[model samples]
Target: MNKKNLRNFLFTNTFFIVLFLGILMVISLFISSNILFKNIYDSTIQNSVHSISELYNENMKYFEYFSSKYQDIVSEILDELYKNYINNIPFSSNLTIENFRKIGIFKNVDYYIINKNGIIIETSYDKDLGLNLANRVPNYWKKLNEELNKNNKYIEGISYEIKTNNPRIYGYLRMEDGNIFEIGILIDERAIPNFPKTVSSLNLNFIKSIYTYNISFIPYSFEFPLLDEEDKNIFNSLEISKGEIKTYTLRENSNGKESYVYIKWVPDKVNNKEFNFTVLTKISIDLSSIVILKNSIIFIFIVLIFFVIFSLALYLNYMTNRIEKPIMKLINNIESGKVDADAETNILEIDTLIKYYSHLVNTLVEKLKEEERDYLELKEKLQMIEKEKDLLYEMALKDDLTKLFNKKGSVQIIQKLVLNKESFSVIYLDIDNYNNILEKLGQNEANDAILSLVEIMKTIFRDRDFIFRVDENEFLILLRFVNLSIAQKILKRFVDALKKFNITSDKPYKISVSYGIIEYKGQNIEDLYNEARNKMEMMKMKKLELLKKLSDVNAEEN
Candidate 1:
């Protein structure tokens, strides 16, 4: 409330209010503009996908038409070759190479005719004429017969020449009387230029057989010049099946350009024989439209925000000066060692804030004093509740008489060990004659004897070992990091100690424990416990047999 201090506070507070308003306005405009830009981008991608789908459908129609026409022409040529056959002449010799050459079917194909004897009786290649094809290719006729038997007259597959290992597409016909007329065409990618139909970014491939239907094994494939190395890579990776259309993005390439690719697979059957073809298309994308629109909208929005903020700031500065003048006078009076009556303002909110701030100061002082007294009282109550909770938990988990973990607690610990895959052994111990002791010394004395046995086990076993009173007369011990021999050694020491340990009861009693221990590998706790119990029953049987023998010897001596 000094003159210099008041002036600095007034200027700093006014500057911060202006800065905060400006930031809020800018953020509001930015968020709205970003949401609008995202909507425009999503709409663009959806439109592009629609357009590309229409283009793909149109191109596939042309490919299907041309393939069907090619198959029809081949069938006609085969009929013409058979028309010259006579009943008296051998079937293969009736259709000579000259007849096939004249029919225009062999213009781009090497023609041959093979008889049932598996000999090429007529061939366009003079060297192959009269060659025993069955001897040369034992499985060739077998495969042809298999296809023909399935009612497929026209079959196409990859075949190689007997003399030269050159590959060719062997499209053949299976005539009656077991005579085969075959046409082998060397694949030329440019031979069927119209199959691709000169569409930009469109590539076509004609696969001869069903087995070579994918890009990796295509017999004939052609790529348009518009498809770059990146597009080719995307095409190669495609795994389209028959009648499938797929779309995916191609990432940064050698030139760091990205694009989208679409592929389709078409399959057709001609005269009961199947053929497959695949089409791949790619298109480049540009973000110029979205970027330009976003930038222009953001610029105009920001200008509008600036105008609104500027008008608001001017009006607020005028009001701030008017309101703070009275506040400054009130502070000065207080600093000059005078008690203020009140601060008044015409604005209702500002008047209310001043009134409430004074009331809040007095209320907070009283509340602090009240809270201190309540906190001390709550602290004592919380300590007592925590102690009670601890006692309840211990009672739930521990046996009342022996203070060993009960069945529920022991099972929980075993489940944790199994989950952790820790190596341990379970030793099941049973009291040999607990019922006899109970009959002789009553319930309380028998209970004391059992407690003494638990104490003896505590002294004999390590602290880490978990001891449990899991049954009425059974005590289970889980020994960690101990093998069968180590567990046996510990149990032996427990029995020896129990023989001499005194049970604090009205009558003296000697305790004996029969134990069965099994080292755990990976079995469930139930299975391991059952196995240990079985071993303890066996030990009990052996001890009974020894006692019977001793009794008989004493009888004979008497």
Candidate 2:
């Protein structure tokens, strides 16, 4: 074939081949990304389903443990009451109730006792103390009593919204002497203290409902719904089989977000009465998170793929330039008026290079500008973040009144010191009779006195140490590298400094200060403050007692 025909055939074939390959690469990339995403989604779904199931099981375990412990507490309290005042009529007296309240059992538990005739004889809770149980007794109580009478065993079961109209789990123990006394413990739904803290950290947005049913599958409460209509119909159509985990898809009416309802059956035997309890946990994906993650991954993948392709194209262009180096040199020579000298040589390569160079150069220049703009925007964002951090530090740490480090600043410094295991002492001081001074000398004089105290405290404490006004009359001094002995010596010096704290007012009163010192030992800030406050209160109380005794002695002398 002639050189012109051959060149045309090669160029057309190469262009078609590259176009087909690009299309195939794009489709393959998309298909692979989608498959990978689906796999990740499926794995996450499986993990979430397993985790939620475990959470449900753990919740049941907690309920069981709570029931057993609650039963033991109730039984112990009843036994104590029976042993101490069974024959005594004063069991119904105020003194007995007061004593029970003081013992901490009544404070922590809600309990009521019923006699053999199903009458509420006594209750730890004040509201139900004198209430009759005849009308208010739940059907569960009757079932419990029947079991107690027949089997002579303890009855325990979970119920919902009975008399108090709230979910509760009850455990009853029959006394030994056929007294038929029953103890009922009310479960607090507000605080599921036994529930695992880890579950709360999962950030699950769902409600769990658990219900107990008899062997006949008749639910006693509305805590959990029965299986859906279709599932119920299927269940009824088939012979009753053993319990199983069932999942149903629940579709939203508005936005069509997918949700799942999971139900598991737990067979329980309480008081010889077989019961099938169903636990229903409803879980839904955070649609926002799902959308955000999906879009973000896709966006990132596309950007990355485009970057790879663009980079590859640039590299291919450089390679093409190397391969077309002779053509480029010939074109440059022709442009410089030297092409006629090489006109006898091959001109096909030079012709093709001239055809594409103008378009390629324009595209590369625009790409460079876009990249530079993105880089500048990123740098501006970093600078803004640094400025915000500085602003936050100034606002949080500086005190408005004295323009010094405030309580927050002191806390930050102290936390760092404690975390680094550095030795320190905290001297908590309160202006004695500051409130009285405010009342007697007025607000203006009190303000001046406070300013004077702050000035004196700043001068006495080291610049490295922190001084903060914690309250209207109380201040804290954080002294670094100080032991208890040094803290006490510093406290003595602080007391002497208080004598010099004077406001230049017409009605100037002497400023007296009381301080409590605590050497830091890696204790929590709250605990340190509490210890210091307790000591300060004791010291103030002793000073008052001494003054009272002196007054008594003066009266005797008179």
Model 2, range 341-450, lDDT digits (tens) per residue? Answer: 44544466656777789779889999999999999999999999999999898778876666666777777877888888899989887888888889998988787777
TM match of model 1 to true structure: 0.35
Superposition error at 217 for model 2 (Å):
16
TM-score of each: 0.35, 0.35
Model 1 per-residue lDDT at 260: 44
Per-residue alpha-carbon lDDT of model 1 for 11-64, expressed as tens digits? 556666766877787787788777775565445445554544555454445444
- Enumerate clash totals for all models, in the order shown: 0, 0
For model 2, the superposed segments whose C-alpha errors exceed 4 Å read 1-9, 59-61, 70-152, 157-184, 189-201, 204-258, 264-277, 289-558
Residue pair clashes in candidate 1? none
Give me the overall lDDT of model 2.
0.59
Index of the highest-lDDT prediction: 1
